[model samples]
Target: MLISDGLGESVVERQHAVGNEVDASVQGIVVQTGSITGDVHFRGGTAGEAAPRQLPSATPHFVNRLVEQDALTTLLSGPRAEGAVLMSTIDGTAGVGKSTLAVNWAHRVRERFPDGELYVNLRGFDPVAEPMTPNEALGFFLAALGVAADRIPAGDDARAAMFRTLVHDKRMLVLLDNARDAAQIRPLLPAARDALVLVASRNRLDELVVREAANRMSLDVLDDAESRELLAHYLGEDALAGDPEAVGELIRHCAGLPLALGVVAVRAVEFDCPLSELVEELSGERERLDALDSAGETGVRAVFSWSYRSLSAEAARLFRLMGLPTGADIGADALAALADRTKRDLRRPLAELLRANLVEQHERGRYRFHDLLRAYAAECAATDERESDRQDTVRRLLDFYLRTSARADYARAGGDSRGFVVDLPDSSIEGLVFGTDAEALAWWDAERHNMRAATLQARSFGLNEYVWQLPRSLMFFFHLRGYADDWIEAYTCAIESARFLGNDYATAYLLFEMSVAHYDRGDVDSSESYAAQSLPYFEAAGDTHGKTEALIGVGVMRVERGDLEDAVKPLETAVSIGQERRDLYTQGASLNGLGLLKAKLGLFGAAHAHFEQALRAYREVGENVGEGFVLHHIADTHRTSGNLEASIEAYRRAAELRLEIDHRPGAAASLRNLGNARHESGDLTGAREALQAALGLYEEIDPDTAAAVLDEIEVLPTS
Candidate 1:
């Protein structure tokens, strides 16, 4: 029989015959159900007898940290009394000292709970073993409460019921470490209105508050100061004081995680070596996480093993697979895709790993492995994950990104009204959804760097198709980010791949992208040569769009070289062809190029008309970045013709757009243009201000445009 009372009380009494004999034991509130030979008795201990003495382990050090003043304030003041479930959760990557803080803070506040203290290691993410069952935990708690085996309930359900009943009305401090979930922990909760329960787990256990009304505490990694203090504890004050520079490097190598820093310090102490030597070993990122650990209990791998041993097979496998992704952080949806499973199917196992503390969710809906944990996961994947499987996973992920980027780029490039689509072998992952166009753009913003790395990786893997398409999809990001080096590097690889594949169209496209990179980087001669290289291939392949883009670039290059007459024919022809093909964006770009050349040729009125037309087309298409360039060209025309006020207004508008898009280099250029306009207008104060800002930008980094800005500043008549 199973019985549960609403007010934290439950009872179960049962009897059985073993080989025609009776088996029974009773020492508490005994009732005989069947064939019993004993009565049960339970003894409760005094509160003073329950508290254990502090062991002579390493001294618990307090490293000063910027308390997330908000979380600290909320925790310290929000719900002070007991029935208030103070569900404070500290979440971070492994080695971030989540457990240490919890333990330290619990000990600091233990005086509030007068009855006694109880602790349990739930082993939520042990790598090699299953989490402790509720029965196993309940047995320990029962034993702690002075309930003997002979008198204790035989079943977990019964034990939990009695455990809660026993703790009711007693103001005890319960610290549940590495709890797997609310369910594993719910049965272990004391029902006393005044009892305090502190449950620590890596997961964002929203289920806790929903079920138990527990208040939450989220912990983050330590800052530089705290990280330093942690290292000082093991390395001693003198070593750190002798070399603050080395100390900073040491803290940085530890990645501001207390556990990692402590382990590194412990290693330093064990080896009896100079701190600078250890710094050199940790400087290499590939071996840093591994090198940070030394022998024995204090080592990071040992600390990690404790949590790893508690995981079931499924969770352990998922943990290993997670390290294979190229991304630095992962969302739930992406993680689900990576594991080839539904989020629903994976949630329980993920939660179990979180409980065991092997995996930590960085934030709500996102997760990342600890540096050391990631290293271990990488090691596991290298051995456990088959080579073919690993290759397949990488290829699928690369394809997913390539196809999605192509879709976004095609949409932005004003393709047909139909949405972009890619077929996947698995029907479950057929479509990638974006909430809005802005959301799609944000995805590019987040993934631009990773995509650049992917392009290089794809080329290294000899994926020729991906090599060509990556540059195609990455045009907007390359242009917007001003990553000239990465743009050139990606295209250089694509060029080699295209030649290898003997594909004329791919060669033309790669050459075109390479030309853009050179043009942006002020290598006008190389830009023209690359552009000329694409012309013959485009002509051979009969690709008009490629031919038009290459022609426009060549015209722009000639205009930049001061050959305005030579620029006129190609610019006009490219504009006519692009307009005839109804490629409005391309036509606008061609007209903008022609306008700049006209302005240089002293045709102000014609330049003005062309700039206005280009501006309108850019604005109509919501191409803010392109519109900014057009507005700057218009300003340049006004400045050339001495229309100072109009030039100032146009320059300001261009600067606004450039700043909006985080185009720092472009903004600097616009500021220089504004200085030129101010000098022409005879506003010396404003001119000097603008010129000084431009000079400051130039001094910080030398770019091609900076020389022109310096000439303008130098030619300004000094007061």
Candidate 2:
């Protein structure tokens, strides 16, 4: 019932000699089991024929869920469920064992469905990962159901329909675990009457119960007996036999929560300490609800406080400092910077917290607090730590995020010609190191929520410099990853920070970035507004690069909005300014904007000349991606001018250059254009090859683009 890490079934290996006779010169003679067989053939069915068995292993020492388990079984098997899909939602507060119960019930019911089970941690409340969207979850389901990757639809609606169709007659168990809301889980449900879906969440999915007729079960904390039983199960009856009174007190202090009891039990066993000592500590922590918790009598803060108080001084300090940042989790390196300790010195303290369950090592090396635990830790920080110390901790933490983000930005850009520099604090000088763009991106993806939270925290603390710089540092990553909401939010914060600090230079820079972000999100009006607003500040600050950037932004927006006449003057002015200052980055960007305008105006020769100039400037600064952009534009001009051969060559070169810098979306676009150009030239074979490659890349990053490309591919000639 439990899913193993490897493929569900083991593969058999057999060796057989097919040739007629073995030579005497060979080392050994072959033995025939029965008789020589005729030629053997291997037949292939659809790939991934077996449904995915992704259920996590059930928890060990699961205790006292008899009534809840029986309720679930009755819901699943009752006669009222004869012809309808059974949907059950288990909801509870943090540390209430919702996921544990879900997994346990799922494993028990594994045999009820002939088709295998599928599970995903939606990470709805995860501080690090954004909750898994319905579309992404459906894609995973479709793949697990053996749908060929290329056959999967590129939109959520189509994918959902396909998923419903695939599971229509099949009896399967679908588990949507840790869902944030009904919307995230709804599209992933199978429409079949025979299939059952189980959802688990921290909040009650009222909509699912009301709209979808889901059976809702609200799991409360364990009762005193159940809590005591759980601890006894983990620590053995003999361990509790000597001090029944202390065990009762421990159970009372744990507030009947499984997670809290488990933490206390782990410590009781690890240190071989008397439960009476832990009880005393819990009773000694001022006996009040933690600042973050509103629960009066059922406070888990007492348990958290007791465990926290038991940690070594070093571990306890690190735990309080971890509360300073608003990020959901903190990486070990960032933790070091926050504590002003080296990575080597952090291992033992981190390990200490991990052992006590004050912090969880979620991913391999990254750690986070449970939402409740994080609140408790923050409360400790506010009550026990000095205000100045808290501010210093926050500053160090923000410094780490900003400096690391800047380094990642530089790495991803492949070296910037803008020559912008971030002055990191001495403590942050040895922040996280990334060796490659891919590594940098991976770290960014993991830390994105933390970064956003840290930015907000900086602003809240009146750290204006960090407020502006943090968002600026993250701009490249956010833009490249297409996080429009986060990009806009961070930029808005940065703009306010700049204004508050009365720094026109920073204001101009952020406005320009915001314009670009808005443009990327297709908000042309806002993009133009921000772009126009940036010009005056740049002029007042006498920042030529800022001025040139604003001009180019305005020009690009005008061109995109089809105002060619208005676009030309600003672009030309930007180009002139770039030339005067010899700023190659700005010059290349402006020339590219002009080329786009000229191309749109049907001045192909003029467009080609501008693109050529842009390419030369980009290459002079070693900006391969910028050069690729210019090359693609040049190819567009060539195509418009009816020079098919030149267009094809230019597109191919552009695609290659983009790929060389790992600009996959850019490469995919160039390849798609190349395919269209080749098709126009009657090269069907070349067109199909290029489009197919482009489609693969598009599917990874932009499924809507992939869908359009698929339509184009379908219209191409096959012969």
Candidate 3:
């Protein structure tokens, strides 16, 4: 250990003005003043005449030939020269020499800090390895700082605090190289005012600016002169002088990008080609891009590829698997769903990707890939995909979403059952939420496209069950997004899938949806036909829910056709089944339909009560649109029974909530009802205005409703 002795005029100033002079020749770990110097030597049985394995030679003059980032260099070097705590950032794009600059700067300033300089390759961009954890890097740092393994703190934060405490009041240099982000670098920062931190990352360390002053340097491609000097220095002073124009072209083609320069230089050496010849070959864009990987490292792809090749089997598989997804980025929880694994199982692979620098962890548990890098991973997956493997992988991904989404839907629907008894991947669903209404809605919104693709793809694979279940799972999004075509297509596909799967019960269930689509399209006969087709299947399958849906569809069709008497039986049966099943969304739809039928049949009291129950149930199940629709129907019942004031209040409530939920058709209906109530209450002018507005929207999506509303408007008394 090293401690500094104060030497100043004032007592406090003198105590703080400390310095250390480490003795180079210490037998064991020794502390003198503020410096620790120790000799590290070991002898083993095989040490006799044996040599250490040689590392490949690093590029010569790699640091010097490059132009320095003055702002970053001055910030990092100046503060530490006089003993001050500083954090400096060197950030740049791929192949920008961020790491080289940081490392070279550390070495340059090492002599000033006699308390030992430490470096950790955080591996921010390694392709397959995970970023080194704080504890792992800190352990290595502590050992370098003469702390034994047993004495190291067990926890990461503890270790970081201890490391910082140990280095406090000492003039030391700390270099955290290739860090992913400030969050990853913050813990490792030394506590002492005398210490300096040089952090290199592709990401700008904006976090440093929040609490402490930080100097940031962003690097771009080297200038033309700098590029030429580096090339001449590497290849010989006269190597490119004869063909200055060609040399300049080569540098320009390399985009003055340092990584490209190194790659081209290495290739020039390997092939013994003159700079002109290399330039000629590189004039083709393809050859120039390939040359970037000349040394199996340093170039963007080569550096990335080297990291990728070093992954474990699981991590490698994951890296390739992410390529299969159509989306650019995936939340970690959704990724775990895609992998058919738990988040815990996913950690190693995610870490490996982070370490290798292939996958970028953008936020607190979120990850993404660079666009070009994603293209590369996609290429890898395409080449790697066997027919069977591709099918199985897709099936697994679809099944995971279907099952998880089903759990979320059930939770949102207020079903108190133990989250869909399915074979879930092992892990607590901590990050993957499902219990709350908001959580379910959020999940559905985020995964809507994936769900659609998966549903369509699953159908192609003969996954009939998935086709039906997937549509069912996505009901919330389909309804919310107002994706009418998708709703029709998904349900149509589900109907075919149900038939193919030999599940007559599911076929009947989907026929109910076909009827709803037909009704939406104003094809009353088609709606009736599909609804009638479900009855026999429901009887055979003994599915109460399917029976109720079919009955509601038939009742609605009859009501539309003015066969109110015929609609009564099916409407009552549907209401009974919905109540018995306790399926609130289905129950609400049934009750709303039955309530409208009763109001038409001159049973206003029954209709009003039914509509109230429907509204309650719809709200309970997080179906606000349905709740609003029922509120409009409740107003209709009130208006029919001559409770004009009650009808106006109910209509107003429906209109407000309907608009909030983006229920355009429902809002139009509610507005029309409000207009009718207003007319009955002698507000003829307001009635004409409301009815005209409702008719316009109804004409757009439902012309039949518009015509009927128009007839009602014609009969309204003049103001």
Candidate 4:
């Protein structure tokens, strides 16, 4: 039976289910009903009144996933008797054929649903526009279901309810492909038991599984046989018949991923190279990933590029910057630093990347790239990103690390001795401002690998100043954390870069910093060599501060080598030069060195005065780390002078200030000193408590110190 209505006209016609016929026409409209069964069919009508057939054609050369196909069929069939709407979610990683399976299944079953089919690419993972809103999806569904434009509700909930009401009695097949999540798909679901919905997504849609009772099917990379069959279907049996081994190698290289296989097959057909030769070219991980490109946008990188290009500008920029890190995953705060964007400002752009499936949020507030996608993003940066822009972005990242790490070092060490000469570039985003040493150390732990990579990257680009400054900024952190290898590698690059730029001041500063790093690692000879190299450069640059710092480095190395007399001479010279210039940092540093020298020589009163003067200078300069150091030194002088009470009080104050700054290592040192003072005073219980706390802090910041503290605690009196 057929019925048609147009502009206040009606026409009807009916053909016999057996032999009967019926027909009716009014103006331009026609309607017919089968005389035997009373079934009506409309032949002519306004297009709006007719059932909409919106299903896209099924994918060609689709091969194998028979199990998934069967599972879907069962889901639809099982739910029919319960009078409940059948909804199945197909979820998987990108290019895993979720969309293909959903669409193919929809086409296969279209005949069962007499009301016709509906389709929409929800574009949940599309990089271009925002994910389809529920209200928008409902409106599209309503129009397709023959609801007038004006009648559709304006609000999302109202539109959804209206859509459900309209589809309540009809048997229809609806395909919601590439949906972002259950929230976006909920409003578009039909209420009718007779209708079936099939959705595809990269996410599992677990909410739908729990709340809506959705039948879920997860798609995985095809099996070897399935991948082979699919490839043969595309390239023809004849093409693959000659070299079975090469075909197997090609499929293995594709990792049974359907998108990769399709891309490779398309290229295999277009090019004349033997499949074996192609496999050889794609053997390398980087080249293999890149080789999956097809001209029709089917290549792995090309497909990724399409998704990448669809992202908002900020999200796109973030995606490209993600390639800068060599780590497997990154926290958002580090990513914010890399992009020079505030963490708050990055939330939406990061969410956009998640929606587009360009990046995955594997853990709360942490994201990672698919291996192939990372390579693709790197390619995009190399090709599309301007050299100047890349350099500027990299500089911002390096500057963020340097400035923040310096702040952290000051909190921990009581002073930063590297002495930056070049002014840092202005940051577009507010850099991290750590309130505690713990916060700063945590940030450093997270970004250590990226920090190392940035130094090398800067060196490669001849950003000489950054190459030197970045490593210098990291020195204190490395010393406290005992990262000797990273310290040496970074300084090596910085030293070469400083020499390349012919900046005598930077060269001297870097050399002094390298000496400190090596000395911390117990490489006394290397430390002295670097310190000796720095002295002439400091003199050449006419930098009295640099000269003072270099002299201190030389003296400290001599003290470590047990050349007490030689150490005394350079240490005295540094103090004189620092006093002449009124360079507070260098002067305080030199005073501390002289204090240590005096203490080594058992000149307790002289050491006390040197430390007191250093403390005053450090306070004048607002260097809390320097104050902590001098306070600890004063405590040592008091202890050596047999004033246990004074030494205990000094250590307690140093520990308190160091802890406030989150300086775990410094706090531990003070606590260790305080414990010894308490033990000397016969306060065993107090000694134990202080020693245990010190051990815990040491364990987190320096395991070697923690072990020594443990030995000290074990030997203490239990009573």
Candidate 5:
């Protein structure tokens, strides 16, 4: 080690000097003596990875919280205890500004830790989406720590272990915001003794306090002075000084809650009359200001009502109808459909709502209400809107979903020659038009929850046509996406809707659809029962197309039951109808059933001939889904005949085709079969690879099947 000659001559002065230069060159480690003046960095093996700065921007115009802020900073600002992590929870009621205070303090002290800050809104109290699960939160944290998603292990325990290892000894801050409970936080606590974890939640998280020894802080609303300061920040000191009496009344009604005060401030600015007038109107509700602020019944409602009454008729109606859908957020176009207007026409109204702050723009072209605001808006809608008018609004909303989903389904399936289209005769509002399959799928992905809510809401309103038609629109999407539970629930409601309407044809179609869903999911007995129930209704309605579908469904059931001869009549009749009507869709179905029946009867030659015919029919009609199914059957036949190489090729083709169309369940089945074929050919590496991919697709869509695939992989030969 060398010390610079420029050092001060006096030893006492040099000892306390800043920026002293030292250089050391050694093959081995160099030992340094005495304290360093500035940052000390050891340059040897590697530089540290980039730290993630994930904290949300601190709230603006944050008035004053010297006491709570001091408490949080004091509790977590110090270095962690030896061999232990520092953890604290800021617990408070909703809208009490828990997140506001936590984020503000985090930003202030972030420079204390050179390592980056990490934050996630656990969404424990989110009104729109489910609270983030422990695994989801862990996945987020690991990804932030620079772990690639594919490299992250399955199961919470594995991910937690990896998270601890990555964060070990790092000086970091982890803010788990809005956590649901202690269980959601424990696994996320870093193993690093140098790290600080600050959590904010509406929940008290009593377990973390008692069991884990986490420091707890219960936040209160702002006191009178702080509340006045907050109002001054928003309205300025001039506005507060202009009318001290009215200002006092405004602050009192707000109950010192930051959110309430913010809304009141906005209303105060927007008010045309004097602030005294606004105060006078709200002063009547002062008697209900009991303990706990009673935000639901008293103060907050007064604030929301002021905002609500201020809206123009158009924006007011939009806000009221928004309370109808259970979805977290809605697109601008969907809102237009609710009001029988175009998206363009609603732009002004949406702008008005934004100005009033009744609806916050969620993302581009989408808007959402804060949960409390949503509840109040809903109450207003119930009180103001008539019964008939409300029902009509639901009809229009459902129609919008039905038409949009149908269009998306058509785009997704490449081309559906099935002649199914939603024709809304009443309203001018239109669903979306897609330029590509990706666009349609993206819409569905974004609007899936809204669509689900629309279906159920239609049922509640007794709009039977929409109840059935809306689900039917999503049938293809539900099938391909392996959303079996959503598919079943959708059809079950549709079936009941059809029954209520006494529509035999509709009932038959629904019943057959249900049977197909059941058959695809491997419930053979239920499939047969639903198929049997549909036959009489189809016959009663004199519907040949519906009858043919029912016959094909029954034929598949009989084939699965190992009664090939009994299946022959219905399959042949279905073929006859297809030939007479030139319905390629029916031809594809009947030919596929015959192929399955022949294969089951050990007639390989006949099965191949039927399979070839089915493939051609499906291809002619642009039915990629049916084509994939026939190819899968052909692969099954080839494997049964001991043609391992041919079976592998065919299964590979089927899986590719199914996956291309987003048919995850079908793809998983084909992949599982492909793995079995590869294993039989003594290609263990290929076998395991195929099985693992299959397992991943199945886990979300079919966990039981995933477990079965896992069993197969476990028993495979390592070599």
Candidate 6:
């Protein structure tokens, strides 16, 4: 604006400088908010330029969000401070339709921004791809603002500066949707108060609210009425009207999530089936998410995938593993245990999941999943994580409840308790340690359902050790708390797992424990029968340790039957073994029972002790991943020593980690090595299975290397 003293007002006016200051030394030309009396008028420079209409197609069937739409209108309809950009962070859980709302509202009010609306997906949460960077977004905005690709600046700062200058005076709506964070949207801001920016993300983007004074409006899952309205939008009112009950069930299944409702609606429209049939298909939690897939990006699972994939590896793993909890929510301590990490170590990953809106922490130290999201996460666990790792996570989860139950039991009992307690894993998450009786009881009450679920889940996974041990750990706790049904139900489950194992020692031990369970419930006849059955097997297995425990049950029956002399020897033997506190049960896993299970599985002799000794050491310290490598080594050693069967078992030695390592891939080379050993040992079927599995893994992690595994599979005898 600095010029010679005689310069005309038209000179400064043509430059779009609004306001006036007459005292400047270099400028005699000043433009003011004044009425001009001359025949000439000042006008703007940007005439006949093309206004960019860069917004993507807005959702056509958008309904509901009335409150949100109204809020946006009010926030954006008014004037703003000069150079103070208007922005609102539209954030919420994934698939809550943040982008859909922002776009439709923009189109509704696009007339105000006559220069045209500018929009970019930002792809900050693309399921399979990395987020678009600020430089990329800026380049996008510049190009939309009519900047040529070749003319675009090379640096982020320069491109951003150019974008601001280009849109500075224009009234426009810039939508930065699915943004990863506030930083990604900042540089794309036009910085003109007249321009409005709507930043949509799964995160709240608090920094934008604090620093930019950005207005924030978070979307929640629709209510029952809103969900029904949304369904009508896609399926039409008659389809919903045909079956009122199914409508209710369908809405419940969708859990008020708009994406799910929309997906279900589409399927409803496409199938032309009775709404009840669709309800039947989605009845099961396991298959509900499958039914919600629209076969595109907007599918419920696909939308969740975008947010899930935005996470770091640690956060992604936490998301999947969190799916394992059977309870409605998990405490921080249990999550740490499931992850084999300390609580302090889990904060970052937990925060990461929170940022991604993958999980919600409703209360302090407690987290839960959205119902549909929990299902999706469980599906991810089943598909994305190794079965072995899943098993390990559950195992650790079960162990946390089992071990902490024992600790709580001991503390609540004033230092005297019944269940067997192991030392907390040194390097792994040490389960909660209670400082008072009330603390122990409170945790027990809160985790009661989780522990019950753990027992059933263990048996279902065929984790026989924990199947029997968990109930045993809580046996006294249940009886003391008068949970008669829990005591009976859990012991019944334990007995089945023990019998299924067919280990005489383990079977007898559980039978003996069950007798006490019956005794606690005052069922003497059932107690006596269980005792008599247990003693024979204990003696058959030469388990003097277990036999002694059974003898007490026998003596109890004999004393009840009025036969004192016959009970004398059983009493004597019980007394004799009672003196041996450090028996097989107390020392560790009874080698006899373990040996029997190993024998049944055809992994006998030479490698048994080595696998047990090494694996026991690793697992005792809570090092499952480290143990995988060690087991691989042990298999290599067995193969070198020519014990092909043991070598095969070693490659498959993921049992103790309490997970099905199917989710974790053993190195393709190692799996191929196991295949060759199985072939050498005349186990053609086993060899073929191992090679095919290895080939499958390589196809994912290293397709180039998969050829060798394919060749290995091709050479196998078909027989």
TM-score of 1: 0.53
lDDT of 2: 0.79
Error of 4 at 195 (Å): 49
Per-prediction TM-score: 0.53, 0.82, 0.49, 0.56, 0.73, 0.40
In order of lDDT, best first, we have: 2, 5, 4, 6, 3, 1
**Model 1, span 1-719: residue lDDT tens:** 33333334446545353222124433333332445458654454453255531211223665744464345434644555555444555555555566666666656666776667777766665442246667667767877776643234433555666687667787677777777777788778776766667777767677877766776767666667777777777777898998899888777655666876765676567567777876776554343234433321124444343344446889888877876764545667656766777889899888986765556885587776644576777667776899777766656656666666766665554443111122323423432556565566766655554565566656666777677667667665566546566578667877887788788877887787789888877799899889889999888878777788788888989999998788888899989987898766667788899898989889999999988988877777666777888988899889879888999999888878786765555667788888778877888778878877766554333333455677777777778
Model 4 per-residue lDDT tens digits across residues 385-404: 88788777667667766677
Give the whole-model CA lDDT for all candidates, comma-separated: 0.67, 0.79, 0.68, 0.75, 0.79, 0.68
In model 3, state the lDDT of residue 101: 71
What digit string (tens of lDDT, one per residue) describes model 2 on residues 1-719? 11122333322323464324323333222233334368843334532266678887897867849888999889876643444578999998767788889888889988888788888777687543356668667767877887644344544676786777667877788888889998898888787787888899988999999988899999988887898789988899898888999988877766777877887787777778888887776666654443323254444666677678788999999888887777656888888889989989999999898877778886687887766666667778888899999988888888788878888888777555764555544553455679877788878766766787788778778888888888888887766655555688889989998899898878888898899888767799899999999999988888888888889989988998999999989999999989998999999999999999999999888888888899889888877767888898888889989999999999999999877766676788899999999999999999999999998777655666778999999999779
Q: Is candidate 3 or candidate 6 better by TM-score?
A: 3
Which ranges of candidate 5 are over 4 A from the true structure? Answer: 1-56, 63-94, 99-219, 235-247, 267-278, 284-298, 308-324, 380-389, 410-425, 557-583, 682-719
Specify the highest-TM-score model's number: 2
Error of 3 at 488 (Å): 1.8
* Candidate 2: pairs in clash: none
Poorly placed runs, candidate 4 (over 4 Å):
1-255, 258-299, 302-352, 362-367, 381-419, 425-448, 475-485, 522-524
Model 6 scores a TM of: 0.40
| Candidate 3 residue lDDT tens string, 166-215 | 57787777878778877787778786777777877878888885655767
Error of 5 at 668 (Å): 3.4
Give the lDDT of residue 103 in candidate 2. 88
Q: Any runs in candidate 2 off by more than 4 Å, and if so which? A: 1-57, 73-86, 109-197, 235-255, 267-285, 288-296, 414-416, 419-428
Better of 5 and 6 by lDDT: 5
| TM-score (C-alpha, index-matched) for candidate 3 | 0.49
lDDT of 6 by residue, 1-719 (tens): 42234543433433355454555444433345445566854444555457888776687777648899999999976767777899899998767778789888888898899888887766665432236668667766766666544344434565666677678787888888888888887888887878899998888899999988899999887778988888888888887787889999887766776766776776666457688876766653343254434332223554455466668899888988988767657899899888888889999999988866679987699997755577778878899899889988988888788778877756543342222233333234346788865577668766765676777777778777778777766754564443444677778888887778686766776687778667655577888788888988877888766676577667655655556557556655654454465442222222222222333334656335634654564455444443554566567656766778878877765323212322223455567677778888989998998777666545433444566778877888787
